[model samples]
Target: MKRTFTEGLGRKELAEIKACTQCRECLRYCPVQEVTGRVEISPSEKIRIYRDFIERTESLRALITGRDIPEQLLKDFTRAVFECTTCGVCGEVCPAGIDTQRLWPLLRREMVKRGLGPVGGQAEMPEVIRNTGNPYNQPPSERYRPWFPDETEIAEKAEVAYYVGCTGAYQAQPMVRGDVLILKAIGIEFTMLKEEEEVCCGFPLFITGQHELLEGLVKRLVDAYKNKGVKELVCSCPCCVNMMAKDWPFYYGKELPFKIVHVTQYALKAIKTGKLRIDHGLEERLIYHDPCYLSRGVGVIKEPRDVLRSIPGVELIEFDRWGRLSRCCGAGGAARKVFHDNAVAIARLSIDEACHRGADRLVLSCPACYEKVNDAMKDYPKKVRIVDIMELLSEIIYGQNA
Candidate 1:
C-alpha cells in the first residue's frame, strides 16, 4: 500500500523547492542511501520529484485549479520523504543551501493533513504518547525508579535541573544512573523532574507531523518547567535538546524561562571547574559518534571530545567521517520505530567504520545512538565496546559508583 500527500503545499515551500541545484551533494551524505543503496531514498531524487511536481502543477494550474491533484506524484513524493532519517546531514551538504531537514517535517505536516502520514509502526504513536506521556507506553512509575532511586538527593526546586528525556529514562537507564552518580560524587547542585512530571519532548511527534499533539505536549511541559523555577536545564539526550532549544520557543509562542544545555556542555564545565576531577584513570582507545541533532542541530562538535580529552590516558580518535561530516546512527526523526531494519543497517555502517579504524571502544552522546549502535554491533565480527560518554566519564570519576 502507498500513501500520497495532496494538501498544504504552501507557496513559500513551492518557491523554495525550485531552488534545488541538482548537484547531488546531499545524496552523498544521506545515511539511508549510503546504508541501503536505494536511489529512491536519495535526498537529491526526493528534491527532483518535488521540483518536477511543482513544474507540472504550474503548467496545468488553470485546468486543474478546481480539479484533483496528481495522485501519482504525491505517492512518489511521500515514499521518498519517509525514507529519509531527517538527520540534517543533507542540508549540511546541500549546494543550494536548502534546508531539507526543515522541509521534510513541513512535508510531513502536509502528508498528515491529507491523511497520508505516519505510516507503519508510527500510526499508534499519538495514542501511546497521549496515554503514557511517552512513545514507549511504559508505566510512569517504572520510568525513573530504574535510574533515580528514592534515596538520590534530587531537590524539588533547584537552579539547575537534569532532564533525562524518554530515551535516557526508559531505554538507557544505566547511562542516566551513571550520569547522576557522577554528578553526586562531584557535588553539583541539581534537581530532576520526576518521571511522572516529565513527558515526551514530542521530538517524535513534531518530526512525524503530529502538530496538534506536539502543541499540547509543549504547553504542558513548558508550563511545568516554568512553575518549577528551574533556571537552567542540562540534558543527556540530543533529540530532547534539539526540541527544547530549537522548537520550544516557537511552539510556545514565547521565550523559555530557562536555558537548555546538553550534559556534555555541563560535563565540560565540571571538568574545567574542578568539580568532576578524574580521580582515577582508564587507558582506552575510543571514537566519538556525534549525534546528528547535536552536531548539526545544536552545532556542538567539540564538547564531547573535549570532555574525552580532559580525562587521563584516553585516546580520542575519529573515523573518516567526523565533526561536520559525522555520520548518523540511523535513529533520527523517529525513523527507528518505523524503519527498524534500515535504521540498524545505517547504524552498522558507522559501527563498521569505527571498528575498521581499530577503535576498541566507541563513545556516544545520544541515547538513541547508543541503543541503535549497540544493537547493530551484536553480530558484528569486531568486538568494539560501545559506551555512552557519561557512563565512561563515571568510570574515571566515581569508579564503582557508576
Candidate 2:
C-alpha cells in the first residue's frame, strides 16, 4: 500500500502543529502576513488548518472510508503555504520553539504529494530543471560563457571548487564574476564544472516541495565534484550552500566527500591571514543586509559583517533589525515566482528602511535578494544602490567595473 499524506509527516512535525499556541506572535513577524495583510496566511493559522486536516484524516470515519478534508479548505491552505516566503523569521520569534523553516517545507512536500501545491510559475520548476538543468529554462551553454571572469582560471582538478548556483549564473552574473575575481586575487586554486555539468543546486526544487529529481541532482553533483578531486566546495549563494551543508548528506546517504563553505566564510580567513588585501578605500556609509539562509539558517551572521568592516575608509551601519532578526528579502521559498507583487513590496521594505537610515549602498550577499531588491529599486523615488558584497569588494580592489 502507498504511504498516506499524514504518514509522510513525521512525529516531530505533527507535534509542532499541535504545539502552536495561537498566541499570534508569529503573525507580526511573518513577511507574507505583513505584506498581504491576509490573516489566513499567518503562520499560526496555517498550523491550525493543517492540524485540522490531520484530525480529519485520522478520524474513525476517515479510516473506514477515506479522509474527507474540504476542497475549499485545501485550496485556502495551499494559498497560505505557498504564499509564505519561508524566511524563518517567524520561527526565530516563535515562543513555542517550532522550526517553521524546516516544518514549512515538509508541509509543502505533503501538498506536492497530493498534487495541490506550488502555485503559478513555481509549478514549472521541476520540469524545467530536468529539461534544462535550471529553473529559468535558458540554454545551458549560456550559463558561464557570457559572464565568466576572463582572469580567473579553472583547474582540471583541485581541492577547492566554486559552485555558481543557477541564480548567480543567470540572473546575477556580476556577483559570481566578483566571486571568481576575488578567488583569483587571493590565489586560491579552484575548479568549476563544465557549464553543462554545473546544473541547478536543487534549491528551487527543494524549496517549492518538488523532490523527485533531488536525489538524482544531489548524486550527480556529488559524484562530479568527487571525481574532480574537490575537497572543499565554495559557493556564493546562501541557499545553495545551506542545502549542500544541511541536506545533501541525507540524499547522498552519507557524509559528503567535500566540505561546504560559504564564500564569505572562506574570504574572512584570507583577510585575517594576509592572503587577501583591500588596498583601495571607499568612503561611504553602507548597510549589510543579511541573507536568511546564510544568517539564521546556517549561523553565518558574523563573517560577512567582519569582512565589510575590514575595508579601509568604510563606515559600516546596521538596519534596525539585522543579523538573526534580519528582514526577509522576500525572494525565498520560491514565493517570488507566484507572489511577485508581494515579493517586490516586501523587498521595498528593506530598501525603504535602508534609505531611511541614510545608507549610500545596501550591500547584499544573496543573489535572490540582490535580484529582487534591484527590481524593487526601479519604482521607488527614495533610492539607494543595491550591490552584492563580492561586487563591491571587486570594484574596490581592481578599479571600476572590475
Model 2 RMSD vs true structure: 1.6
Residues 176-277 of candidate 2: C-alpha lDDT, one tens digit per residue: 988998898889899999989999888888888898899999999999999999999999999999899999999889999999999998889999999999
Q: Number of clashes in every candidate structure?
A: 0, 0
Model 2 lowest lDDT segment of ten = 1-10
Cα-based lDDT at residue 209, candidate 1: 80
**Per-residue C-alpha lDDT of model 1 across residues 279-299, encoded as one tens digit per residue:** 667788889999988988898
lDDT of each: 0.81, 0.90
TM-score of every prediction relative to native: 0.93, 0.97
Residue 210 in candidate 2 has what lDDT?
91
Each prediction's Cα RMSD? 2.8, 1.6
Poorest 10 consecutive residues by lDDT, candidate 1: 1-10
What residue runs in model 1 are displaced by over 4 Å at the alpha carbon?
1-15, 58-72
